[model samples]
Target: MSNPYFQFKQFTVWHDQCAMKVGTDGVLLGAWASVERARRILDIGTGTGLVALMLAQRSLPDAKIVALEIDEAAAGQARENVARSPWQERIEVVQADFKKYRSSDKFDVIVSNPPYFVDSLECPDRQRAAARHNDSLTYEELLEGVNRLLAADGLFTVVIPTDVVDRVKAIASMNKLYAIRQLNVITKPGGIPKRTLIAFSFSNRECVIEELLTELARHQYSEEYIALTREYYLNM
Candidate 1:
């Protein structure tokens, strides 16, 4: 069986009960999203609460983080993971549908490693399918919630398949959100980028684009990836 938990430098995430397990996408979003000086953060579709915990670790001592999960089991596991972490006091795990979620307080930063598989054949497991497919939470719904809950100056960050980057950008544009920063993630040297990380804001800013290579060769991690994730990944 796959390991039920991922052991990070600062926390342990047990995901046996969650449909989604720990993965690099969540780590990338957690570590790469801009969190400097963020006093309040929201993590949408926090399947295992991985990103939320990472943000808590990166944020200031007084920062408050909310990890929203649509699945009850996943939320429970997230709560357990947060409870065991050193930053438990800084994180709250909420089980709610993001489309209907309401928060009186605006967030300084919002992040999600959202489902990206579009119209693909789904696996038999219903929970895993929900976690992996976009049917449960479309980019439209996700951005709508971001628009509603984000502070005027807050940034919304997401990691999605590079193929759909333009589509998402168009959706964000419709919502009056502009892409301010982007990071293309390549699997290896000279390999095509498969995933793109983007940070959007209500106010237009000059878009900054960068690239990250996960490896120089198979099983050999690149320096850029190591440096970006050194704080959370034990081996790095």
Candidate 2:
């Protein structure tokens, strides 16, 4: 059986009750997102509140973070994880679908490691499938929510499979959210990029492109990857 919890440098995430557990994708999105000066943040489809906690640790002490999860079990576990973290007071876990969610106040930064499998076979486990497949939250719907809740200068960031990068960018453009930065995530030194991290904003700026090699070899992490995630990983 998988471990019930993942212990980070500053926080512990217990994911036994969550459909999706703490994994590299969530960690990468949480660590790679630029949260500098963000006074208010939102994490959509937060499975175990990992990204929310990480953002809380990175953002200003006065920053407030809201983690939205559609699944009841996952949202409850996220709340439990947040309650145990140092930033309990700063993070709020809300059980709600992002597409139908509403907020009076806009967010300075919005991040998500959303369900991206658009055409793949669904997992037999209904909850796991919803957490991984985009049927529960399509890119169009996700971007629509970001467009509605984002501040004028706010940024919406997400990590998705490389195959869907272009499609997502097109959708973002349709919503008037232009790509500002992108990071290609390669698993090994010579491997093809499997995921791309993108940040979108209201203004059309020159997109800054960068590459991140996660590992030099099997079990050997790259310096850049280690450096980016060292703050949260317990043994990095």
Worst 10 residues of 2 by lDDT: 114-123
Give per-candidate clash totals. Answer: 0, 0
lDDT of 1: 0.93
Candidate lDDT values, in order? 0.93, 0.94
Expressed as tens digits, the lDDT of each residue in 1-236 for candidate 2 is 99999999999999999888898899999999988899999999999999999999889999999999999999999999999999999999999988889999999999999997789998999999999999978999999889999999999999999999999999999999999999999998778999999999999989999999999999799999999999999889
* TM-score, per-candidate, Cα-based: 0.98, 0.99
Model 1 per-residue lDDT at 210 = 99
Residue-level lDDT tens digits of model 1 in 1-236: 99989999989999999988999899999999999889999999999999999999878999999999999999999999999999989999999999889989999999999987887999799999999999989999998889888999999999999999999999999999999999999997888999999999999879999999999888799999999999999999
* Clashing residue pairs in candidate 1 (N, C-alpha, C atoms within 3 angstroms): none
Question: What TM-score does prediction 2 earn?
Answer: 0.99
Location of the lowest summed lDDT over 10 successive residues in candidate 1: 114-123
Report the Cα lDDT for residue 185, model 1.
97
Clashing residue pairs, candidate 2?
none
